[model samples]
Target: MDIELITNILFAMVRSGTPLLLVALGEVVCEKSGVLNLGQEGMMLMGAVTGFIVALTTGSLALGVLAAMLAGVLMSALFGMIALGLRANQVATGLALTIFGAGLSAFIGADFVGKPLVGFAPIAIPVLSDIPVIGPALFQQDILVYLSLVLLVLVWLFFRVTRAGLIVKAIGENPWSAVTLGLPVLRVRWLAVAFGGALAGMGGAYLSLAYTPLWAEGMTAGRGWIALSLVVFASWRIGRILLGAWLFGLASILHLVFQGMGVDMSSNLLATLPYLATIVVLVILSSKQSRIRLMAPMSLGKPFHPAG
Candidate 1:
């Protein structure tokens, strides 16, 4: 369509994609350390509620964001204890985490329903934001938008250039050998889980504090699961995670745009596009299981013990 229309669409994609990008990136890190956290939804919900409450109470968005990250870390640490420390079933513990987060967020956020909170406003870069079509859509965004990109870069660099990054990679590839090398496999996994939790918390906070500026129960609305699938869909690569999140985000926003255009269709059906796309991608990837096996972390989802 027109340049204006195209710009609006691009801007919508960026806005819609940021939270997914954040969550998926965090998950990549978590999975890299051989921990499959199915509790992304729960962690995100906890973050959203905790972040909103802190922001509303203190009138400081930054403090609220910090609180949200802390909440995620605590939730994830619980997962680490059950899955990593106690040597429980990783998949089962993750599923339980999601259920716990949903009920807990509902109970804690029940009182704050319908209350409006100030959200992050866009910060336009002076000269760059004023440029023709690209600037505003790409450059003028809230702090978290930029932070998400920075996090992606950091994650890539962590795996690429740093010694700790190599150690984490080594642990993910073969925990037994990592242990043989005396790399502190359990401790590394715990740190990775905590880091992933923080990023997931940040993602959830971005939703409440920037995207919606309001608190709602189960507001994440399957984005967490979508983020989970995105990690696999990307084949555990950081760049692909970026592309996949935006693709899903664009699909998500299109349903809204369709409704705005007064297209006659079931809204519920339209809303299913993103989830449908996720399933399709998973099926495609699964059909090529050999490729996935090569890309995936060797010990993913398996609990590790030093002696075993």
Candidate 2:
């Protein structure tokens, strides 16, 4: 393929992958703290609607992103209150959060459906962006693209270098032991959930404010679920999350390429490739029982109680 073709594919892949990367990264942190938030879809939907509404009203992309993050945080906080504070079942509460988010976002965003905002503009670094084929493909992108990469690096360092990260990991491995060690298990878990929610919201904001720039009731589609799968595909590791996101991104963009090239195939069938790919990856990863046990958070989906 020509450089132009290659660049187009690469750019599209990165754009497609960015949101997944953001969501998966946040999930890693949440899971590392023994919180399995199946509410990613709900949090993302709330973010998309809230971000689109705020940005459309204020004409400020920054505010839109902030609103989306706030929406995510609030959704996560609700999950925390139920699952952590009240000692409810994490799985059931997470599912409830998703359902609530879907309904609430649709109700709130009813008026704004189909409206389009100007959205964020791409930024090109002066010298770097001028560097031939690699420039536009790599450097000439929106702020969120770079932010995703930065987040990956920071998260890696957070897990590898920081005491707080270790504590969170320890809690995931054994919350009961963490409590015995006098660690503030519930507090740390809440914070991790908040951080995860913020990132998921940002992922949703990118969908509305950059990817498509229009309001749709379910604009997030199912990226949130894909992101959840990505966490498992990555085996809860930071570096693998980045790779897994790009792999899924490529799968997502394949349908566009097929349609563009005048391939005669059902659009619906092509659309299933990304989701199908997700299922395939999950099956493969799950089959290796020992590996999964080694990687998965031990206390994931289990409610933790200080008084118990």
Candidate 3:
């Protein structure tokens, strides 16, 4: 059925968007707390490898996830230490982490090239999944897809209601006041970065265990970077991350459509759709609201250390 094809496509978009949503959520948290975290790409790639390796070794999905989270935490700490503790340049450190992550994943993943995880099987919700056309498309999905939605609501509530969330925003706006009020700015950032890294790692694991279920060199293929851009495109907001991920997910699925349609084109150009969309969206937003680009962080890519 043609409807089935389109239905499947929509389902794929949700699955594809899940990883981006997870990564962007973390980046949003870090950005909210006044950390740019360029090392997101690196952290993600390392998580991908670690997740893949542990799953292959232990035959346990939960253990693999834990391993991946630990790897992400370790790598993100490296990023935080360089950029935050040492007060190094955020941009430079992030770039270096990206490079290191790419190389390290490639090297470590060499032995596991052909092996892949079995990954999560999709589950259908009771009544909703039984409905006609849209039912299977929207209602039935993997655990991560539903969890992403739950995260959306949880994050929104956190920023809007919680005092800790308020502290994060306050620190981002004015560090001096947060410090004066006895807020542990550095500690907050540390927790934020660690949580963000763990989420990104989970995102990376989703790509391996759920998205592809395979290990390949550079498998993330800039999805990490795209997720990072999405945090900006969403203006460090939670709800917008859902929208942005879906948009990018659609952009990605377009490539598959082109292939299905048998359009003769270079594989390279065909694969560039999602990245192109990221750039185009950035340009459009910049042109539309140069002044009110609500997606931008006021203190992005800036380092902060309390005065002794």
Pick out the ten consecutive residues of candidate 3 with the lowest summed lDDT.
288-297
All candidates: TM-score: 0.93, 0.92, 0.90
Q: Model 3, 193-214: lDDT tens per residue?
A: 8988898888888888777888
Candidate 2 lDDT over residue span 188-210, tens digit each = 99999999999999999999999
- Per lDDT, the best of the predicted structures is 1
Candidate 2 residue 246 Cα shift, in angstroms, is: 0.9
TM-score of 1: 0.93
What are the clashing pairs of model 3? 235-295
Best by TM-score: 1
Ranking by TM-score: 1, 2, 3
Better of 1 and 3 by TM-score: 1
Ranking by lDDT: 1, 2, 3
User: For candidate 1, lDDT tens digit of each residue in 1-308?
Assistant: 57887678878898899988998999999999899999999999999999999999999999999999999999999999999999999999999999999899989999998999879999998999877777877789999998899999999988989999889878987899999888999999999999989988988999999999999999999888989988987878898989988887787777777788888988788767767766766666564465456478878898898888
The local distance difference test score of each candidate is 0.89, 0.88, 0.82
Stretches off by above 4 angstroms in model 1 are: 262-277, 284-289, 292-294
